[model samples]
Target: MAERSIIIIGAGMAGLSAGCYARMNGYKTRIFELHNLPGGLCTSWKRKGYTIDGCIHWLTGSSWGTLYRVYEELGAVQGRQMVDHEVFVRVESDGKTFIVYNDIDRLEQHMKELAPGDAGVIGEFCNALRVLAGREMPSDKPIELMGLVDKLRATKALSVLKAMHKYGRVSIQQFAARFTDPFMREVFPEAMANMPDLSISGLMMALAYGHGRNAGYPVGGSLEFSKAIERRYLGLGGEIRYKARVERVLVENNSAVGVRLADGTEHRADVVVSAADGRTTIFDMLGGRYVDDSIRRYYDKWPVYEGFLQVSLGVAHDFSAEPQSLAFRLDDPVQVGDQSRHWMQMRHFCYDPTMAPEGKSVVIATYAFTNPEYWNKLYADQEKYRAEKQALADAVIDRLDKRFPGFREKVEVVDVATPVTFERYTGNWKGSYMGWMATPATEGTWMKRTLPGLANFYMAGQWVFMGGGVPGAILSGRHAMQVICKKDGKKFRTSTP
Candidate 1:
């Protein structure tokens, strides 16, 4: 057989991973990215002397297990140091402070102390965490390509299954509602850190991973981590075209054969894979002709993750003693755009030395927008957009000053990225931080990589999967590669850095 060629769209984790795997399996591959750089949404930008990480709080599989294997294969974890924080987050309200200790025992103790009357609920939740400790997320195969053996291997772990079944559809908000204590009811839902709709089981699994020290922060932040995979892909002889925006998937005879660049250049390939934004790929690039009722329902009704704005501050002072993440109620509601923020969450880069200059620190303050469309529209008017950005920064800086007195004057660089920033830069639909929202109905749900009537084409990215992250992106690409190799009757292969 002749050598097969693959055209992958987007130089994000998924696209890069697919290229790497394609090269490992003896297929020719090239990746096209819209940005001059790689990483897509998994990126970081330099401001002044600090690097602001736009994605990844803590990678789910920095230490070991199935995800670790994927990270290893993609060269994301090769010689990479991970920082495991003792405290996941420290949240405060009024006079009360709640710390989410990565150590489960400490968490239980802290919870029990705060809400002794809700000890039963706390114990139950913590016990569930124990059940999920070291539990591996299913990555052996995508459901579309899984056989009897693969299915069996996936479900053989009865403990994980039982835990998942009991709490898989239950939201963290629902679990928090079970607590009798007022404080527990208020803060328990926040343990997952703004993702209240995430399954309780999913939250448990994260705490487990954090407690087990398996998932930790990659020292180099998001972009460098992505560049690691890009390097691996290139090392494997895969090609990448930066600033090469894909205009459309070239379909002939109901099969993807190649792609046309935004520059009007056509490139032929034996198979075409999209790791770009989901809506853009299905509707815009493909002309919305291949979608079925199911696909339409997904794009129409299924909620995409929304409402994100990040404010990064480069402080001349060190906050190494402060928890990696801090969430607290504001004395005054800071109004920015259409949303008023009474609460604040700040993530410090004290753990990662690469993020800041020596003796300085990078602090990121996150605020939720009621509507991403507000930012999208606001971008059209540059004056309003710049003012809103400054307003948000000013408000956050004021709050930061309140939290740590005398620290405001030490601030050097202040950068604000709104939802429009994500959409404009990564071309992600609606500036969604994660592709699809992780709701009770969405979690553990599988979306088909291939659309009906579209052959020789597959999708790999956060958009294809609901539980969006670097790991999911990597696995989605691997799944695409596996499906392609299987179709060609060739054994799928993976090589480590």
Candidate 2:
């Protein structure tokens, strides 16, 4: 039999993983990327010797878990050093401070000390973490592929199942309102990195992983991390083409056959897998021919993670002793385009020495905003866009100077990245870094990887899975490969190098 060849679109986390696994399963594969480099949103850039990271605050499964095997198979976790932080985040408002500790016991004590009135709810929260932290990670394989034994393993953890049932539907914002103390009420909503709409169940799982030292930051940044996986794919005899923008999925007889590039070049393959932007793949590339109502509802009604304004600074000052992340409310909100901001979170990459010079560190401030049209319009006017970027950076710098005192003088470089930058570079719709928002209703929801009427085609990445980011991206890729192997009457195979 001639080797079945597969063509993949978008060289992001999901695309790279699919290529690697396809090769492992004895299939020839090639990946086409829109950008000149890999990683897509999972990347970083250098400015004046400082590396400004755009992704990867912490990668879950860096140490060991069910998902760790997936990372190992994709060449993401091996030979990578993981740094576990003691504190998750330091949130401050009006001189009052709240720290979320990785250690659940210590966090419980601190929460009680800070807000004795809310101790009942505090115990409820801490106990959930304690229970989940002691539990083992679930299987990484797709649920449909699991055997009876695997299904039993998944359901045997009654405590974890009960915990999920108890708190699965509660949003962080809703839970924060249940606090009796005024301070707790005000700060709890923003505790999970200012993602108020995120399900509390999501936070519990992450904190649980962190408590076991299973989740941590890589010593290098996001780009280097993505490069590791790329190297793995190349080593597996997979081919990748940079600057190859896939414009359309060539379909014949209602089946995906190959792809046509922007420059009018066509490539034929036996199978096609897209890890590209969800909106473009369904509505544009496929010409809206293979979608049903479910697909339409997802695109129309689902809430995506809004695009944010990022201010990057390389400072001459050392911040080795400072917290990795700090979220504080400002008395006076700084104007950044059409949005007004009250809270700002500054993240300093002091733990990873590769980010900055010997005596300096890289600092990033992100302001979340929802008005995508405002940025889309501003970007059209080059002068207005440039001026807005500078203004946002200046306002962030000024605020930092007040908080840190003498901080402005230590700055050596200033850079800004907007929604326009992301949309232009990665082609993500609305500049959403993560494809979908991790909300109460969306948690654990799985969209069909194969569109209703499409054959020989599969979609992977954050779009297919409700929970976005690295975990969803890699899993979706693996699942696609598994489905393809099953269809070809071959067993799915994976090997760790």
Candidate 3:
């Protein structure tokens, strides 16, 4: 019999993972990517001898013996060096900073020292995470939406419901309200104030803090991480084609048979997995034929997470006094018009100086929540848009100048990337960096991988799954591959050979 063919759309982390897994499991696989390189938004760009990572803050499961082990089992970054951040992270605001320590005890102590009466709240948070650490999650495998209830029942029974009750029902905003300390409130406001409506469950919150136990970064940045996985995929005889935009998942008689590329290239496949932008995959490329009215409406109404305008700077001096990455905020608490005023996020390459030339450092200032219309108008008036971008970069530099006195003098190169740039690169609608927000209505109370009435078609990455960060995308890819592997009656190998 001929070998089963699997065609994966997009070469993002999710697509790469799905392709890697399918190839390892005896399925012939090919990946199509619009961009010349993979990794999508998790990619990095080089500007004037500085490497600027796009969306890397802190990745969970970088430490061994954590839920992230799934990545290692698949040989995602087996030999690569992972940097475990000693201090989890810190938010510097209004001359008062809150440090989240790697050690829970030390973090609790810091919280108590900062706010004495709020010890109970901090203690409860720790206890909740402790309980979650003990609970065993169901297999990472993806299955039919109809089979979720049965699978959960068989795996954890009432425990799953109990877990949801404890961590899934409440939003981060509701939980942050429990604190009486103003500084603690400002320090850890749960959801970013701008994202108040974004659905963040209690379990996810715990996992966020739980990451402090093992905060980390990949040595060569996000792109290197993607390259490592791609290397593994190709090592297993998997094929990847760049500039191949998939037009449709070829379906015959309610089963996916193959795909047709934009260049009129046709490739047959037994299964098709899409790791591209959810909106594009669901509505545009597939023509929304697989999704139901309810699902389609959810997509139309779902607000995508805010986009960003970033300034990648190569500084002549070092800003490595601090151990971990820092979040620098504005003096005035209220929101301001300039994207920089909304959130002045500064992440430096002090930990890894190799990102820049010797004696210099790479600093990225991201101003998130910018309107997409601003970029659209830029194309009409190039000079005016260029001036605006320079002004925004200057303002961010001014803000950093206050934080790091005379910081502007060292700036050798400043490259600005707006939402339009992200849209052009990743094909995300409105240049949304986080895909669609994983709200209750959109992601569903129970996460569903495959859309209704879709034969041999599946959705992965931030759109359909739990909408987690890097780990979520990788898991989504693996799960989509699992669906194919099971249908083929092959033994599902969890680890790479």
Candidate 4:
């Protein structure tokens, strides 16, 4: 039998993973990326001798587990150092501060000390974290391929399921309302303000993962981790074409047969896989002919995660002693686009030496939920757009100076990336970092990789997975290959670096 040929769109983690697995299964594959690099949203850029990392806060399954195995197979974890954070987050409200420590016991005690009146709820929360920490979820196969034994093995997660059932219904906002203490109420909401509607179960899982030291930041950050997988795919004889923007998925007789590039060049293949933006792939590339009611509902009504306006600085002073992430209420609100932000979260990359010089650090502040259309329209006047970015940076720096007395004077470089910047670099719809917002309404909702009435095509990316992240995106690619392998009557295989 002739080897099936596959043309994959996008060189992001999902596309690269699909290529690697395809090569391992004796399939011919080629990947086309819009940018001149891999890693799509998982990317970084250089500024005045400093590397500004744009993605990867904390990677789940940084240590040994099913996810770790996938990382190892894709070469994402090979020869890479993982930095385990001692404190997950530091939140300040009014004049008081609280730290969420990696140690559950320590975190519980700290919360009790901070808000002794809310000790009961704090204990309940910590106990839930402990229960979740002891449980593990299987990731070896897609749901369609899970055998009876696999189903049986999942029974081990009953305790986790119970905990989730109890807490998953409550939003972080509602969960905060359970706290009687004023400080506890403010702390819970502020700590997870970026995902305000996240379930208490989701928060518990994150804390559990952190407590186990399973969630760690890669030493070199997002770009290096992506490049590692890129190298692995190339080593397995997979081909990649960078700066190759795909204009359309060439469909003949209602089947995906190939792809047409922006340059009017066409490449035919037996199968076409899109790891690109979901909206573009469905509406623009395929002409919206294959969508069903479910698809329409997803596109029309689903809550999408919002993009951010990021202000990054290369500071000459070391921040190694500071918490990795700090969220504080601002005395003076900063104007960002059409909205005014009264609070901000700052991420310090002092632990990653690769991001800056020995004595310096890379500090980033993310102003969440910035409107992409606002930036998109403003960018028509290039000078005005640039000025707005600079003004936001200046305001953030002034605010930082108040917190860290010498922050303003010690800054050597500044780089700002807005929602429009994300849209230009990555074709993500509305420049969302993640596709769907992971709230109670959308969590655990599985999107079918194969669209209704579409054939010989599949999608592998965050767009197809609810509450998408590095693990889910990479695994989604593997699941696509699994479906293909089953269809071809061949077992899916994986290769290690």
Off by over 4 Å in 4: none
Best by lDDT: 4
Clashes of each: 0, 0, 0, 0
Clashing pairs in 4: none
Give the alpha-carbon lDDT of every model. Answer: 0.87, 0.87, 0.70, 0.89
* lDDT of model number 3: 0.70
Q: Which 10 consecutive positions of candidate 4 have the poorest summed lDDT?
A: 437-446
lDDT of 1 by residue, 392-419 (tens): 8888898889889977799999998888
TM-score of each: 0.97, 0.98, 0.88, 0.98
What would the TM-score be for candidate 2 when compared with the true structure? 0.98
Model 2 Cα lDDT, one tens digit per residue, 143-243: 66888888788886778877875677788988898888888888876667678887888788888878888779988899998999999999999999999
Candidate 3 has its poorest 10 consecutive residues by lDDT at 333-342
Residue pairs in candidate 3 whose N, alpha carbon or C atoms collide under 3 angstroms: none
RMSD of 4: 1.2
> What tens digits encode model 4's per-residue C-alpha lDDT throughout 63-113?
978899999999999889999999988998788898989899999999999
Instruction: Tell me model 2's lDDT, rounded to 2 decimals.
Output: 0.87
Ten residues in sequence with the least summed lDDT for candidate 2:
134-143
